[model samples]
Each structure stands twice: as structure tokens, then as C-alpha cells.
Target chain A: MHELSIAIQIVEIVEEEAAKVEAESITRLELDIGLLSGVERDALEFAMEEAIRGSLLEKTQIVYNFIKAVMVCEECCNEFNTDDYFNSCPYCNSLKTIFIKGKELNIKSIEILKQ
Target chain B: MCGTCGCGEDEHITYRNPNNPDSHLHEHSHFHGDKEHSHAHHHEHDHSHPHSHDHSHDYLLKPGGGALNSQTIQLQRKILSKNDLLAERNRGHFEALNIVAFNLVSSPGSGKTAVLERTILEKGSDFNCYVIEGDQQTMNDAERIKSAGAPVIQINTGNGCHLDALMVNKAMKDLKLPENSTLFIENVGNLVCPALFDLGETKRVVIISVTEGEDKPAKYPTMFETAQLCLINKTDLLPYLDFDLEKFRQIATQVNHHIEFIEISAKTGEGFNQWYEWIVKHRLSETD
Candidate 1:
């Protein structure tokens, strides 16, 4: 799955950051993965386990925070949570809506042991 | 790091010509600046040190404390920002060279290769056309484009589902495309992953064949939403199939109101004039 590639990217980024800080090893990693980010959480976790071997994050504890998709209706400006893209506004029944959240894929923080 | 894929820059991407079995492999590694400091800002640190006087116990404990003194560093950065920055660099390069790059995306069997073949055949003589074909394996598509008379490079992505910005940047270096030229990047045949990657193209074109069903736009809204042009290919078979063109258009519009559509038949050369004209218009505007 594409999650493998994403996991590899995460590992690469953390390794680079860890090296910059002169970290002996990474102890913890926090990630923000949104529902609309197009990433499967389980697959990413599994991939990370495989990708982190023999790397800076070999023994790191990974934490993922799932963000629910929130939509803002363009017509009535009503905010609601939704998982589907074709959903309409509940208040005005308008099809025109934009996602205000739940498209984020970010590295929130990391705990590293200084060398 | 290799410039071909953003996931791991060190990963090697093989580029080869289909016609020549011994075609020299073009290998390039794009190393972004290594001097950049870590964006990690230390927010909290465990300063408690469990100092042990026993010589044997001290060897087991870390220098700062019995356990490693770890600090939580806040980054709060987008995971794909590296790819985005590389994409912006590609966009700037294209602009400086007066090149118009188009990223063509679609599902497998969507006639992307056919449409490209037809386009090159019709416009190759008038324009300096170069193509970058992305596939999991094989140089078949590159061969087709080469036969069509356009200089082509094949990117074997291995297990990659999409071509990221870095790959295009690497291909651009190997191609060394001249000014006032047109570069078409045929992305890997997948509607899901490619939607998330930006290859720094002048415009993104998503092609869907009538045989793929009318609900494709609704099912894969992200691809349609990101694309500027939606080409409904294989219109020649429209009369023979149960495909509803109007319904397809309506659904696609509902998903992406700003996307423009063109009904085309790459096999019969129908509706290609408008497609060519669209390219010409965008190319001229890009230069201005």
C-alpha cells in the first residue's frame, strides 16, 4: 500500500532530525493523521514497524492522533463532521461545502535521547 | 537521496530506453541541503539524574541519569513539505525555461498511453515534446512514446504507486528539456495516491474512459478536484455502451465545479483539435 511509502518518509524525516540534534536514539514519536489525509492508520503503523528497524527510531514508541473530517457549508456557514466528500450541509442542504480540517499529516513531536 | 522519489531519496530509480537494451542507465541522486538545522524546539526535559556511586551500576546507567534524559521536541511540520518545496523548485525551473509541463493521471486502461501517442503524433512536428512515463515496472509506455517520435524517459517506480515531485525533478535533469518545449508526465496508473502528489506541472489533466463507469468522479473526488481538465476518452464507443455522458459531466461538475471537460476519442482522432488548442492556449499564456 501507499502507507509503506509514507512510513518510510516518516522514518527518513525523523532520522534526519535526530541526526541534526545529535540524538543517540529516538524514544517517542507523535504524528497527526487526519481521516481525510488518505492514510490507513493500521497500515502505516505496521509499515513503520518494518521501516524503523536498524534506524534511529528502532525502539521508538509511535503515537498517532486521528482527526475527524470537518466540513464548513458554503451557503449557511454551518460546521459539521463528515467522513464522506459528497455530503451536503445539514442546515441548508447545500452541496457546496469545503473541508476546514481533517487533511493534515504532520509530525507533531519527538522525544530523543541526547548523545 | 535520489531525486526520483521523495519517500527515500537514497533509493535508486532506473531510467532506460525500451528500444535499446543496452541504453545507458541514467542514475542521479538529488541531495537537498544537509546544513539545515533541526526544527525541533525543546519544550520539556527530564533533568532528574539518578546518580549511582557503584562502578558496575554506573556503567548500566546513562550519563545524564539512570535512564536516558529524553527531551520532547516540537516540530509541528507537514510531513510532505520536503516534496512540496521540491515541487516549487520544479515549477520555477519550468518557468525559467519557458516549458509547459502537464501531469496526466488516470486509472489503468484509461487510454493515457493512447492519448499521449495520438497527441505526440499530431503535434510533435510543431512542438518540442518530451515525455516522462511512470510505471511500477517495464519500459513499454516509454517505447510507445518513442515510437510516436517524441523523446521519452521511463521511470520504473518499483513498488511506488505515485510519482512525487522529486522524480519529475530528476527526470527533468536527465531530459534537459529545451526552452519553449512541452513535457508531459504520464503518472502511474492510479487514481488515489497520485491525487495527493503535486509534480509541479503547469496543469493537471485527469483522463477517464467511458468504460470505467460514470461514478468515477464521485468515487475518486480528490483526483477530479485537483485536476484542471477532465478528458472523457473513448467517446467513439459511447453509442455502443450504456455510458451516460451528461450524467458523467453533471456528477464530475458536482465534485469539482471548476474543472473543464473535453470529450475525446484518441483512437479516431475525434475531439483532438480542441485538446491541442487547449494546450496551445495554456502554453502561450504560460510564456506571457
Candidate 2:
């Protein structure tokens, strides 16, 4: 699955932070996963946990914060969030809207053991 | 019973002896009276006070430490910026070579490789073409292209869902392509992840075949909308199949009005000339 590749990135991000902070163990990892990032949260967690073993982040906990998908109306400059990817703005029926958010995938923070 | 310093952890339990220090119930860091321990915070602190250690707490806050905060922010920026640099480099490479690269996307059986093979055999000797094939495992498509007598480099994505700019950069090193070449990258067979990654292509071509049904453009509009051209392949079998050419184009146009449409039969050589003329026009337009 693509989650495995993203999981590898998660490990790289956490390990980089751990080395910078001189931390021995990573306790928790926070991520901001976009709604439209095409990543399943549970799959990412499972992939991260499995990939972290035998690495520097053996005891890490991965927590995901999902970002809502927001689109901006081209006609009225209105922004709205919708579960449907192709739905027009609820406020206006403008087809000229562009997706503003919900494409982000980043490691927000990493909690390393404060040793 | 008295509350000490308004800290919530040392709540007065009626059954416990207040004078005995053992009555101090171990509470979570949120109620640990440390204002710095807001939510999921971790740090080192010299807590030499006479108390038991609780590493089981969700996180420990390091009091009087500001350096760690900046280091965390710096690392986040570095990771993202590194990838951004590689993507920008890829864009520059495509531009300097004067190559109008279009990333081709479709499902596995949607005839992407077939369309490419047809395009190469028809216009390969004319356009100075090259292909970068993406797949989970195997150099089969690249080998097919090499047999067709065109320069091609196969990039085994190796479990990668899509082709990123960094991968393209590595594959470019081995390609013996001339400057001003027409590069076509056939992305891994998927409709979702490939839409998200921009591989520094001049255009994105979304190929849909007659057998896949006409409702595909409406179902996967993102791939259709992002692409500059949408090619509906397999027109020769339209008589045998229920595919309507006008209906498919109309649905696609509703989603992406500006998308250019091309109807070609890659197998029967019916619309290959029109496809080649379009390619030649695009390539020749680059200099003008």
C-alpha cells in the first residue's frame, strides 16, 4: 500500500527530530493528514508502528489530526467544507470553485523522551 | 482538609491521611500543576524534589527550556524544503531541455501502454521521443518501447503508488535523449494517487478507453480536470461496444471545459495521423 511509503517518510521525519533533540525514545508522533491526501489514518498508523520497530522509534505513538477539505468559490469568494469532492459550494452553486485545503500531509510534532 | 496552592492534583481525599506523603495520588501531567505541561509536551527537567518519578505520564514538560522548541520547528521546515528543492530542479530540467512532458494516467487495463506503443510506432522516427515508465515491478513496458525503436527508460517504482519529481530526476540521468525531445511518462496504473503528484510535466494527459465505460470522467473528475488533454482510445471497437463518443466528451467537458479531446484507435491505425499531427504541432509550437 502507499501507506507504507508514507510510513517510511514518517519514520524519517521522527528520526531527524530525535537526533536534533538528542532524544533516546520517541513517545508520540502528531501528524496533520489532509482529508483528500488519499491516506487512510488507521493504515498509516499500522504501517508506522510496523516500520518503526528495530528503528530509533520503536516505542512511538502515531496520532493523526485530519484537516477538513475546504474549497473557495470563484464567483462569490466564499469558502466551504464538504464531504463530497465535487460538490459545489453550499452557499453558491458556482462551478468555478477551487480546493484550498485538504491536500496536506506533514508530521506536525514528535514527542521524544526528555532524557 | 486544605487545598495547597490551588493545584488540582493534591485533592483532599477523605479516606487518606493528609499528613502522610504516601497519600499523594499520582495524577496525569495535565493536573500535575505545571502550566508548561499543556498537551502532549515532552522535555528534560532537573526534578530533584523529593517525589517519585512517573515516566508513565503521557508527556513530561521541561521547564526553562526554549532551545528545543526552535529545533523542532527547524527540522520540520528542512524536511519539506528538501523535497521542494528537488521538485523545482525537475521543473528546470524539463524547461531547459525544451521538452513538453505530459504525464499519462489511467487504470491498468485502460490501454495507456497500448496508446503509448501506438504513438511511438507512428511518430517515433519523427519526434525524437522518450518514455519514462512507472510500475510496481517489472521493466516490461520499457522493454516494449525499446523494441519499438525509441529511447526509453523504465523506472520501477517498487511499491510506490505514484511517480514523484525526485524519482523522475534520477531516471533522467540514464536517458540518452537529445535536447528538445518529446517526453511522455506513463504513470503507474492508478486513478487516485497519480493525480496528486506533479512530475514537472508540461501537460497531464488522462487516457480513458471505450471498454472502461463513459462514466469514468464523472467518477474520477480530478484526474480528468487536471489533465490538459483527454484521449478516448479504442474507437475501432465502438461498433461492437456500447460506447458513445459524443456522450463521453460531453461529460468530460462539463467537468473540464478547456480539456482538449482526441479520439483515436491505437490498434487499427485509424486516428493515428490526427494524433501525430497534434503532437507535431505542439512540438513545433515550442520554438515559435
Candidate 3:
């Protein structure tokens, strides 16, 4: 799955941070994965488990904060939640709309203990 | 997810040329997110710096029990920023070389390779063409494109589902990408994962054959939404199947307001002129 690659990326980023700060072990890993970010949570968590072996994040607590998919209707400025695309404005019945905030995958923060 | 050995860990991604056996194999490191391309690659950050940290990212340090200090680094970095940055570099590279490239996306058996074969064969005389084929395993598509009389490289992604910008950048260097030519990157067959990655192509072309459902656009909306063109392959089979062209166009347009469609059959010479016209027009518009 693509999640393994994403997990590998997470591990790489954390490893760089850990190395820069001389962290013995990363205690926690938090990620902001929006619904529209096109990543599955359980799949990512499972991949993270495999990707962290023998790395600085070997014992890190992985926390995922899934953001809901929300779109703003350009016609009426109404915000609506939908899992799929092809959404029409519920309030104005207009097809003009775009995603506001559900398409980001970011590493929020990391906790590490300096040796 | 490692397809080759099934060890659930990624192996090195390889690029091979079926036509040139002497220079067929080129292997690269699997550290996708790391800036290092080689095992001996050094980090720019000094390992033994005296100052705490001087990075652009925010730092929050609190005293731990005794001498050991535990700190929280508030780094709001995008996961694919490395890939995105590399993709932008690739776009600049293409601009510098005056090359027009397209990242073709589609499901398996959607005739992506077939479309590539035909496009190269038809347009080879007009302008130079090179290809990079991506799959979990095998060099089948690359060989086929080679048969079409073009320099081609096959990127075996191991268990990876899609081709990242790093893979393409490496492949371009190996391809000896010429000036004022065309490059087509045939991504892996899966429509879901490939939608998230950008290869820094001039445009993305998503293919859907008439044999598949018209609801594919509605089903995989992100792929359609990101693509600039949708090539409906296997139009010759439309007579037998229940696929509705009008409905498919409507649904596809619903997801992507600007996605243009061209119907064609790689097997037969149907709607090829328009496809060629698209290649020429887009190349002029993008490069010139």
C-alpha cells in the first residue's frame, strides 16, 4: 500500500529531528491526516509499526488526528461534509464548491528525550 | 507490501532499459524521504553542534528529570513536502530543457501502455520521445515501448503502489532527457494511491476504457479531478458494452470541471489524429 511509503516518510522525518536533537528515543508521534488527504488511518498506523523498527521512533506512541472532509459552497458559502466528491451545494443547489481544509497530511509534533 | 519477496519491507527500486542490455540496470536507494541518494550521503546538519538548535522549525524544550532533557518539537511539516519540492525542481528542469512531459494515470488494463506505444509510434518522426514505465514488477511495458522504437526505462517499484517525484527525477537523469522533446511517465495501474503523488508533468492524462464502468470518474474522483485530460480508450468495444458515453462525460465533468475527454482505440486507428493534435498543441502551449 502507499501508506508504507508515507509511513517511511514519517519515520525519515522523525529520524532527522531525533538526530539533530540527539534524541535517544522518540516517545510520541502525532500526525494530522485529513480525510481528503487520501490516507487511511489504520493502514498508516500498521505501516508505521513496521517502518519504525531499529529506528529512533522504535517505541514511539503514534497518534493520528483525522480531520473531517469539509467543502465550502461558492454559491451560498455553506460548509458541508461529504466523504466523496461530486457534491452539489445543499443550501443553494449549486455545483460550484471546493474543499476548504480536508486535504492536508502533516506531522504536528514529536516528543523526544535527549540523551 | 513488498511484492517481490513479500517480506513486507521495501527493496531498492530499479530502472532498466530493455533495448540497451549494456546499460539496462540502474539501482537507487530506498530511502524515499531522506535527502540522501546513497548510503554514504552526509547530512548537512552538523551532528556535534554546540548551539541547541538553529533550524527554521519551532522548538520547545523543557527540563526532564535531572540531566536528561525531554523536549517537544512543533514541526508542522507536510509529509510529502520532500516529494513536492523535488517535483517542483523537476518542473524547473523540464522548463530549462524545453521538454513537455505527461504523467499518464489509470487503472490496470486501461490501455495506458498501449496508448503510449501508439503515441510514440505515431509521433516519433515529428519529435523525439522517451518513456518510463512503472509497475510493481516486470519489464513488460518497457519492452513494449521499446518495440515502438523509443528509448524506454522500466521502474520496478517493488511493493510501492505509485511513482513518486524522486523516481521520475532519477529516471529523467538516466533517460538523458533531450531538449525540445516529449516524455511520458506511465504510472502504476492503481488509481487511488497515484492520485496523491505529483510527478511534475506538464499535464496529467487519466485513461478509462469503455469496458470499465462510467462511474469510474465518480468513484475515483480525485484522479479525474487532478487530471487535465481523460482519454477514453477501447471505443471499439463500446457497441457491445452498456457503457454510456454521455453519462460518463457528465459524471466526469461533475468531478473535474475542466477535464477534456478524447475517445480512441489503441487497437484500431480511431480518434488518433485528435490525440496527436493534443500532444502537439499541449507541447507548444507548455514549452513555447
Residue B262, candidate 2: Cα error in Å is 2.4
Interface root-mean-square deviation (Å) of every model: 11.3, 18.1, 11.9
Question: Would you estimate the TM-scores of all the predictions?
Answer: 0.85, 0.73, 0.86
**DockQ of candidates 1 onward, in order?**
0.37, 0.10, 0.38
Per-residue lDDT for B1-288 in model 3, tens only?
122111223445788878675575666555543322111111243233121223432233334434545789999999877788888999999999899999999999999999888888888758688998999889899889999999988998866678888789888888999898899999989889888888889999999999999999888888988899999999999889999999999999888777889999999969999999999898888765
The alpha-carbon RMSD values of the candidates against the true structure, listed in the order shown, are: 7.6, 18.2, 8.1
Model 1 C-alpha lDDT per residue in residues B219-288, reported as the tens digit of each score: 8888987899999999999889999999998888777777899999999999999999999999999889
Which residue segments of model 1 deviate by more than 4 Å? B1-12, B18-21, B27-68
The candidate maximizing DockQ is 3
Please give the C-alpha DockQ score of model 1. 0.37
Q: Against the true structure, candidate 1 has what lDDT?
A: 0.80
What tens digits encode model 2's per-residue C-alpha lDDT throughout B1-288? Answer: 001111111222111112232442222111112222111111243332221233554235455542222223323332234345666787688777777677899988778888888888877867778888877656678777777766776655444456666666655655645688888889888886677566777778898889887878787766777888887888888889988888888778656767898888778877778777777777776656
